[model samples]
Target: MGLLVVKNIGLLLTMSNRLAIADAVVVIKDGVIEWVGPSAEFDLDLYQDCTVIDADGGLVTPGLVECHTHLIFAGGRSDEFEARATGVPYAEIARRGGGIAKTVKATREASEDQLFELAVPRVYSFLAQGVTTVEAKSGYGLDFDSEMRLLNVAARLDKATPVDIVSTFLGAHSIPAEAKENRAAFVDDICDRWIPEVAQRQLAVFCDVFCESIAFSVDESRRILKAGLLAGLKPKIHAEQLARTGGALLAAELGAVSADHLDFASKQDAKALAEAGTVGVLLPGCAVSMCKPDFPDPKLLQAAGVKIALSTDYNPGSSVTLNLPLMGSFAMAFMGMSAMEVWEAITINAAAALDLQDFVGMVKPGYKGDLVIFRGADPVGPFYEYGGSKVAKVIKEGSVVVRRDPCGGVTI
Candidate 1:
């Protein structure tokens, strides 16, 4: 946490209005960026003993932020994945006890220690891809006890790893099979028992509900989100992924932080989100893996002045990959986002989606010293590459956390 300086950055994409800069110098002190600008403008004699890192004329940018992920589950959903590939509907699969329900059973059957062990590598995988911060959700465990265990595992992972984990209580990810018949009572339990408990224990910073036709309805999502807001926890929603169901409008009305997976959101919804100052987070990984590429109209959202963010939605069944670069590729190819727009989606806009815009996301002074160096041609070179983003080194809190060999293997 001492003084550290990075000099000779060839292409520094700050994710700011000023955009990329050439030959930049970034001075970090105590794991926080103290100064960043042209290399010529940096004063060398102020702290002669500072550790210096030469960028080797490489492209440097803010470390990626994965704002949406369900990476704290104990089991894989390969069966459900294959079933969906064969044209089985998610609702039908869930009805037959094969979707999230299956994962819930596996998660509940596993011990807290087992869940902790399982989540460690998942966090590492994101870090290996230059993701320094992550929003990991606990949704596979639908019951209160199991949900608490999952969240505790997430918190423990945050302590064990260098990557910052933002834990979310997604107790309304789906109604458990046991509570399917009595939906109202189960919802009441979530509003009364789960929200208060999660808030009191400081178990999660955000509370999320899957608002869709196959999951909680718009009304149910509203009830749960309102309860969380009242309990002093921030609100987020899995909105309009399966169907519109008014989730977008509800999120805007409730003043939620973000509305995600908006494959079916309308232009009106985009306007409402922009008016309400809510971020629109997309999951192109899920679209590419499961559904057709009928994504939320990026042009409508952009024209409406809605801020956009992207995530892997890294889950067992829908989006199995933890590759943020791949999601960027998909965003450009499938979601009609440009290279620069996609970069902001994963970095600055992602931090905004998590309500952490002031801290992480940008390579600016007063922000955390989380940075990524890429072996690429220019600022947008890695993102535009075909196979994968050529990540060279990942620095978090002024420490080199992950490094990639010349042969393309990542080590942390």
Candidate 2:
């Protein structure tokens, strides 16, 4: 049996009902947390071979989980950002054959080996920020060949990166260029052809659709999501980003694990989300990147008692960020969410959105040994330091993955 101990934790954010634990010690055995409590209560001689880590006054918390991101794709869209900043709307650019279509074209052109190399550095960038698990979607590949290749590339990335990757099939991200004239036909092809193939190959865990006025209409969204559900693939929706098209209600109806990009959610959407237990994932980085006039109203969702989570929305066209702290800070400053709220959003709440809350979100006994140790005395420093790296140590499955200046430090 293998054992690991982290002791002398100055501050521990358990992310439980009790919220915080002070002067805590966590014990792990065989990749699962065995004990977590005051240091005085932990027994040192419980295991045979052991490894001890000192977290000395540093903050220890569950590893951050990013529930929504389009991390796998070919090329960059920095040029699109420049155009959008200079008084151009994203929809107008898309009408001119830009946006997802542009990436779709590029992604389809690139080989799997080329895609893998570009994405490896990007995944490491996220890991440097203390992110341990990420849900990556294949929306850039809006066609069968490209979409499948993107998912295949995402699967390949798991072996190449330290961060745990979850892939989703998003063939209905947008109607392809070939199917531009017959959008419904494209939807039918996705449901009949692409989704089945993806499921047969066991490539994706969930299926998603972009439910918007400019993208898929309300009926189309419902139809595609329904097909995905019937195929034994869980459903998720990119809903209400540009307009309130009852996407939240549709997610509730479909029993989706989560619905993301609710920047334009109405009161009814908020109410439906709360009642349905559908996690409301807010992407403030998208707003920051696009310079949108208004951000999502956190108060309305919070008032409705909706479970809200924050994500980087790490995509090429809109949000080019991969840092969860930056996204959390944006949620705090612009969305008016508190630090505690943002913390919960990325940790426990984000885990729940990905259906991984039972093990990964909390640093509790019997949970997956996934936690981060920040360099500072408090957790807030990770955000307050802003652009600097605060990830002192990263532990996944009871194994130390990333450590900074690892001579000697505190452990809890």
Candidate 3:
């Protein structure tokens, strides 16, 4: 975490107001970016003790940020994938106890150590794909004990891995079967008991709810979010994924940081989000995984001047991939977003969704020295290339964490 230098950058995307520089160089000191400018102006005689990283004319950008992910789940849902491939709707499968409930059951049965072990490899997967920071939610455990277990595992993950894990409380993900008879009491438990405990323990920075017909009603979501807000946690919501149930409007009303999975959000919802400065996180992976033709319209959000961000929404039931670039590809191909917009969505815009824009998103002076070096010079290569990782090296806080060799060998 001492002096570090990255030179020979063929193309550098600062992501600060979408600035791009050619033949750039970045200098870091004590895990903070000290200077970033053209290599020609860099004083080679100074800082000879610094560890130099030759970019080899690669494209360098800020480390990718995954703003929405359920990264602490215990089980997989491959069977649901097969069922959906056979034309069964996701909601119908969920109604039959095959969606988040199935994963919740498995997660509740898992020990904290087991969940941590299972999540380490997933964190490495994101690191290899150039994701340096991830917003991991705790929702696979609906009960208080199980939910605490998930958040504990996420905290452990942040220490155990190089990738920064931002924990979010999502106890309102779904209603457990045991609480189905008395949903009001379950909501009360979340509002009165779980939210307070989580806030007191500093277990999460944000409180999130899945506000849909399949999950909590708009009023219930508001109650949960307000409880969290009063407890000093910011608000985020899973809105309009399966249907338009007034969740987006509620998120805007509550001034949530982000409203995600807006597949059914209308233009008015877009306007509300814009006025409220809430990021609209589009999860294209969910649409592709569920075989649903509907996706969040980037055009509509853009027209309304709403900031849009894209995420993998890495979870067991619906989206399972950790490839952020693949999600960017899906955004451009199906959602009518350009390559520049896709880049911004996963970097600066995504950091905004997590309320970390001031610290990590852009490659500028005073920002953390987290960056990704892609193999090619073209800034759009990752989105253009569909399969495999285009990342050659990943740096976290001025230290080399991941390096991929020419023969597909990875060094961590």
Candidate 4:
């Protein structure tokens, strides 16, 4: 809330072409970055009334940003998790009344307080791992009333925490069983009724559709996305996760913000995405959990000049993780990416996925003062040591929001 200065940083990963800086000084005033450069040039007279934080020769970086997650639901899907791991077809599981449907039933029965309580702990988990901003989707509530309630719960969670929440409307995640008799009617309901209501209320910043074989068809997905666009929300898609249903090509055609989970996306699709300047988001965490063979080709995507991002996909059914560091490790070992690439995937490129790169992804003058200070000597320590954190402090909006305990726990 006041002037703050961070000095004596051993290493700073700026997510810029130059990447790393040494002996850096960062100056913040009124929650925005005022200056960043070598510590030798820091003007002492400029910060006479500022709070100074010595970084103790440690690693500093822009706070992590999570691009995709499904943390707003009632119950866990451990049973479906096991079924998928054992090679059961997801469609069959859904038909047997066991997948997202099961969770939707539970979410509909849960009250707003219950939903908010369930979501708060998850936010803490993300913050402990150094994620300062995250995108949360409302897919479990496919109907109007529950869907609205889910977004409202997300709003409440945002108000209750320092971590910024970006709510996404995913009403086309699946077709309700009751609507199976006339899927057309259900699609119409989403385009004609749901999009307008969510948009008018300003409950969500973006609208996403599950454009897969198990969910909406290409035509259906396009219609839903178009309706959301008309209603003034950005468009994104859960494209090519299981099978290529023409989602990626469609995303590029319309210049959507991102096409996520492109496990089965072709090189042609990657090229299209690159040309359109759409982000190609990979979800290696979900691939590892689901044992998916066709993990996205990061090298190909990179060669095509596409900006790549990684995510936890922190849903109960597929990727049951908020540990993005682990996801980074998985991206390197399994998705054929370098440590620098993985780091960029979660920072600069990930910010682009949310259309917030200009504001939050860099430690530059005029950017938001969101940063992570690690106790280690190098910025890569947090990604190198998966399932662990070397974070000494987490700053959001120029204020210290989280500090590490001596016992390796987080405190606020």
| Top of the candidates by lDDT | 3
TM-score (all chains, Cα) for each model: 0.97, 0.95, 0.98, 0.97
Q: Which candidate tops TM-score? A: 3
The stretch of ten residues in a row with the least summed lDDT in candidate 4 is 287-296
- What are the per-model numbers of colliding residue pairs? 0, 8, 0, 0
Per-candidate Cα RMSD to the true structure, in Å, reads 1.4, 2.6, 1.0, 1.4
Candidate 1 has an lDDT of: 0.88
User: Residue by residue across 153-239, what tens digits does model 4's lDDT show?
Assistant: 889989999999999999999988788899999999999999999999999999999998878999999999999999998999999
Candidate 3 Cα outliers beyond 4 Å, as residue runs: none
Candidate 2, residues 87-130, lDDT tens digits: the string is 88766877777788788888888998999998998888787678
What is the Cα-based TM-score of model 2?
A: 0.95
Candidate 4 C-alpha error for residue 364, in Å: 0.5
In model 2, pairs of residues that clash are 6-412, 7-411, 7-412, 54-410, 54-411, 55-410, 55-411, 56-410
lDDT of 1 by residue, 289-320 (tens): 68555655577788889899989999988888
